[model samples]
Target: MAYRPAGLRTMDEAQDMPPQSPAPAGIGVRGWLRWAWRQLTSMRVALLLLMLLALAALPGAFIPQIPQDPAGVATLRADRPQLATWLERAGLLDIYAAPWFAAIYLLLFISLIGCILPRTKAHITALRAAPSRVPRRLTRFPVRDTHTTTATTEEVTRAVRRALGRRFRVAVTPEGISAERGYLRESGNIVFHLALVGVLVALGAAQMIAYRGQAVVVEGRTFANSLVDYDTFTPGSMVTGDDLDPFTFTLTELTSRFTVDAQARDFAARVVVTEPDGRRYEDTIRVNYPITAAGANIYLAGNGFAPHLTVRDAQGQVAFSQPVPFLPEDDFYTSRGVVKVPDVSPGLDQLGFTGYLLPTALAEEDGLRSVHPQPNAPLIVLDVYTGDLGLDQGIPQNVYQLDTDNMTQVMDGAEEVKVLLAPGEEVELPDGLGTISFESLPRFAAIDLRYDPTLPLLLISALAAMAGLSASLFAPRRRLWVKTTQDEAGHTLIEAAALARGDDPGLQRELERVMTAVRATTPTTPEDT
Candidate 1:
């Protein structure tokens, strides 16, 4: 007899009622779209997203980042403008803050949430339900063993039950025994996923609500939380100017030592800090040791000399006196800078001057050079330009560099300008410009100070993220089931099988343990003697 389709037969039997149209053979576009959505929201999709997220973060870790340090970025841009511009346009300059990077992480987090929430609900339901019944075909299981036992089947079943109860999940039956274990694998998997979500939330919260600021401190200077005080400030989106800490500190003393006899192997700086509360503390701040207090960190980044300069008008009245910071031009300690007398009293006169200070000044074919860092051969060369200094302009200017755009050199006065000066020496001014004087010098160490309210949170979140990654990658959900049965010859048969939803070494070890336990319970027969 030929077989007929079940649907066609049902339709023929119900022909007296009403013939129904056949359902479509294949799902249309809408159905396929729905199916695709379901797949994308599945656990497999979540796993793929996690892998992509890890891969996306690799470039940021390996490459230099602009958001971490803008000065370093500037240096790179100056060295390679074309490559830097392409990187900036491609969002590699600030990878963490890029839109594509943000999208990757956000989608990954959403995928995790989708996977974990439903899985948690399913796990809870399964936990409340009773253990499933043992399948009928014990021989079809992956592992099977046979033994002849003198004890009755009931007694053997009881002994097996007692042994399994100690370490496994047991389901007793009249014919045989069934046991399972390793349910904690699923529990650990859930924990690892939840921990990853926690880490992401913590890091996102810190990045969105934290504030960071940096300031350069010369030795013996105190600064407050003002706009003029900070050399660089990076505030989070939720942070405002008022969120800055009101504390102030002064670098009272700074000490530095270099390896003069050796090949400059060791260098260190010690700084004394005086807080706003009048408490004084000393900290040895070196290249590696950063001082932390009042939500700020102080690092001894560099050191230089601030020479004391004095200026007097033609009438022999003291005009200006202060220590001007100079930058080192060479490793041998030849420093060069300019001084502007904007506060001269002689009818608002302005003077432009350039000077080079040497610790151990020596004349060579290539002009003056300093032999050592210390001021052993103190010498100063000055070049004076007398004209309008353009101080009245409403634009900010660097004190270290002079802007002679609006200035002119006085007639013959440029020739008379002193190019070299020793200690306690003075260069008299003609045409009523001013008399430039070189006084004593004081050693000043350059300190870089910073305050980031969220640095601690960032560090904690990074560590937690690493831990979550390890847990998620190493933990697996697995289950082991052991079923035993009896044959006609009174031989007891044991079968052990395992199911793993993830790949992990621990799960494999657990399966091995279950097999070992089942083998231990099997009875052994003696050889034919």
Candidate 2:
């Protein structure tokens, strides 16, 4: 080398180095967006999104939903303020409608469509297209065989095509016959994806028109199909006031028989329903069974006691009279309730009472315990109060609670004075306040109403998904080629080969079957290797 610099590499050294082209350009915004689209549409991403959707539903399973239990949400907030604050902030109480949950739902939907559309189109194209062209070397196939035949090339080609045409997509040429079978493998895949998408769409449509609610129906009370009749109603966003079907039903009676261990063994409610068309019918609503009427199903969820009470002021005027349903606190049906008489004598004060009902009261030494669930020996105990009663300001109060903010407890200074009365008994207050009576113990049923128009469609789609999955898993795709050529002795040389779409274990067997069938028609040698 003539005067090469010390730091410079010689030609041989340069030749040994790998070629260095211009630095690869970074992808632009549009290119990056295309890359992201590909990633989002991939089956792996769709599977991940499905898993995320499942995880998003977990909170709904664990948390007490606000729509179903509005009062319970309030109770939780009061019980654990900080945890309630965090849960509310995260929308865990309303998991289904939360923005994050909807986002996952929508993403999974889009990913499934993106992952399925192109594959469906490709399958359709393949179905319409001709069988694959014959390869150059027949011996290259996984299963191949050659046999001698005393027949012309044209005759052999025509015979082979005719044989395979019955069961496969067959194509014939001067040199060979090419055929493909089992198009159902791809068809099943398409059906599986399409069915899954249909299931999702059907569920979404059902959710839009469905409504579920809870109603407390006491014995001898008629409940009409009205928004006001429901104790807690959660209607779909698309529901309107006019959508109600306008049917009515009365809870005639509720009967129950409990086990010796205090667990409920059997409960039944007799109901009489009136349809919109002036038709009447009798139905029984049980714990697991539902009563269906006018596209709505009524489920008997729970049962409790409602103490029928009557109260009179000092002037003997009826102040309050109704069945106040008490919430059960234990298995023995020991329950609590509230009563507020806001329209009492204007000069003195309004009266409020907080009380508990025992199904079968124990002796004083037993300390406020209930011995049974039946109301044969029912007792009501109440602590009275009197005050300004805040009804004028119109703040909503829970029917199960008393607002004691502007009230004075009617007590004996240090000990709270309580009135205990058995069924059909009355007690006169200590002062010129009122007279309280426990009239009867009538039971109430917590009934839930649900309606969905697309439930049948969802069921069909789910079945279709299962069927398609079975077909896709069990079907296989395969191709076969047969060639006919002349040997030096002027005799026909028959060659047959087979290839599987994947690693099919039955490819050689299928090849043997076809070869034997074709040879049976020809009455010639058909050797299988």
Clashes of 1: 1
lDDT of 2: 0.83
Winning candidate number (lDDT) = 2
lDDT of each: 0.66, 0.83
Residue 420 in model 1: lDDT:
67
Residue clash pairs of candidate 2: none
Q: Candidate 2: misplaced stretches above 4 Å?
A: 1-111, 130-185, 259-265, 313-316, 329-331, 347-355, 360-365, 368-372, 381-397, 401-418, 430-432, 473-529
For model 2, how does the per-residue alpha-carbon lDDT over 139-235 read when each residue is reduced to its tens digit? 8776987777666777666666666667688878765888998888778777888888888888677656888888899999999989999877887
- Model 2: ten consecutive residues of lowest lDDT: 520-529
Query: What are the clash counts of all predictions, listed in order?
Result: 1, 0
The positional error of residue 290 in candidate 1, measured at the CA in angstroms, is: 3.4
- Which 10 residues in a row give candidate 1 its minimum summed lDDT? 261-270
